[model samples]
Target: MKSSPQLPPGTCDCHTHVFLDEAKFPLWAARRYTPPPASIEALTALHDRLGVERVVIVQPSVYGSDNAATLHALRTLGQGRARGVAVIDDHTSDAELAAMADAGIRGVRVNLEVDGERDAQKATQWLRRTVERVAPLGWHVQLYASLSLLGACADMLGSLPVPLVFDHYAGAQAQLGLQQEGLAEVLKLVESGCAYVKLSAPYRCASPDALQSQEPLTRLLIDRNPDRMLWGSDWPHPQPGARPNASDVCPPFEVDLGKTLNALASWAPDAATLRKILVDNPRRLYGFDA
Candidate 1:
């Protein structure tokens, strides 16, 4: 068998999803896309091969507010090595939230891009209420909104009681380059320790060339607040639909773990910084013990 890339002990993949046994955990009827099953076993093997010791299973939009699949995966992966981010609405009860916390879920996700303006008002209300509910649990809010939406919600996001984690570079458009709308506000959040940005799935937001070209932005974020940064594989990369207004489509779903690691290594100036990105930052964010 091929060897996994060497990484610091306690390295964590801060974002990933486990779509398993759809028969048991069916997709939401209103889901935008149906992804192939990427089971717990597959995720474990992938993480093991990447030399990652811990993972965070983000609840995909396909499951809507039903986090059974994510919760099940967390249990299968074992609480000691796994944490989760779930999707919830105001209808979710405190007992349910308590159960999720016991099952290793430490955060909630809000996908504005998927919800759209038709539901925007309700989604915003849900977000505010959810934030209030989870604040007492010491849980962060994970968001998958576009740059424009992010900029529009900047003030409210900045005022969130818990930490805010922006998934996939806050969905910045590659064609826009460093001048991407709302990026400046995102940088401010990072600078102020009010947010975290995951350096994951560059393909989702930027073409390979654009990603390479935007090294300065990446470096600026890292340099500005290394402590508020995190990394993830976005493994079994889910393709919900064609990116809106993006001239280039995302590459194939296959994730090259080594290449991802190499890119991260290239972005970091030294081993210590790399360790922080791979280990320390995630440890702090996800409550992974040293």
Candidate 2:
């Protein structure tokens, strides 16, 4: 394994996942992918070695609504240094939400892909209710949804009391170029200042699957709003079960962590601007110490 790169002081990794150790919590039957062991101890050491001062443990889709692993990871990391985004359903009670707040979970994830909408209306209603429930805790709603639905949900998102965060560069179609309507809608969201967007996962968003091609959209998003943007390493990328091609079995491409840091220059401000992405912005969004 590569030695973790040293991060700037006060840096924060705003996106990373924690998977339940099978020995402790067995896999969910509906999980679409099997994640490798990503324990709290392992994650902390990654931060220490990388020089990241804080982290946000986002709930991976593999766990669905089972946030025990995420919560446990938070407890292990302790308050001030760590926070989390949980997967939740409409039936998640207020007490449960309150307890999550206490446990340093400042966000909830709505995984539209896994939740598959037989009826889009029903799914929308469920999501709306969830947003209302967590509003009091000052928690943002983290979305992993199709870009096509962004405009349709714009009105609903504006009604939300807390900020909304979109993952994977707003799931844009890299082949279609930035003119893609989905990317435009994402820009509109940021233009209005109602949402925060992650500049992580360029590898997941690029055309021909090249990180360099992703810089244009990254530039656009940062240009739109520097304050609301953040960056992360989707650490230990779960190797896709089915190979896209021959390279599937080969070693995956290295995440150019510095490229993300340097994107602050192309997209928005300089390293100081990048500093907010690593430090202040997350502290405000996830309630970590500044």
Candidate 3:
């Protein structure tokens, strides 16, 4: 295996998920995909090897809205280096939100592409409420939805006092291409400063017929909004429909981590820009300490 990329000082993996043992944290009964087991210890080792200094653990949909696993990992990795994004419902109490904030959780995630309708209205309401409660604490709302859904949310998002972080290049893909009308609206949001985007999942956004064709689209977004850009690993990747297998057996779909890190630098064309994507941007957005 190739050695992990040696990140610059203060580097951060801005987006990723940790799937724990189901014997302990049972998978959601309604999960759309079965994720392979992943752990904080394993992630720490990955980070150590990669030379990444910080990370933001986004709660996966397979766990529904339960954030206990994410919270516990944040507590254990107490270098003041890790933060988290959680999924919550409207019924989540003010105290619970505050507790999460104290536990290095600086954001809440609302996922859109799950197998079934997962209560978008309630999730939006929860985000609205949580944003109000966490405003004093400087937290943001991390949104995991397609470009179309994000376009719909753009107007409503401006009313929130916190920042909105978009995942997976705002879910634009080569198949949709630039002609994807919804992405134009997204670019406007990024331009208006209401949105931040992660340059993760370039593979997901690539055309199933041709992966190399994705570069132009990814580079376009990077050029358009370098300051608001971020990078992620999406580690222990949960490929849809495939049976879950060990990393050694399945090997994370064979993308080159070192090359991915290099691509971020190439896209932005500056060391400081890449650092901001890897470090400062995520730290400020997720409230990780320096």
> Residue-wise lDDT of candidate 2 within 160-247, one digit each (tens)?
7779998877777566687876667678788888888887777777632365677677777877887888877776555444444422
Per-residue C-alpha lDDT of model 1 across residues 155-273, encoded as one tens digit per residue:
77888889999998777766677777788888888899999999888877766444475466668778888888899889878876645432223333655668767767888888888
- For each candidate, what TM-score against the reference? 0.91, 0.87, 0.87
lDDT of each structure? 0.82, 0.73, 0.76
Model 3 residue 96 lDDT score: 89
Best by TM-score: 1
lDDT for 251 in candidate 1 is 35
User: Model 2: which ten-residue window has the lowest total lDDT?
Assistant: 244-253
- Identify the runs in model 3 with alpha carbons over 4 angstroms from their true place: 1-6, 115-136, 207-211, 243-252
**What's the number of clashes in each of the models?**
0, 0, 0
Scored by lDDT, model 2 comes in at 0.73
Ranking by lDDT: 1, 3, 2
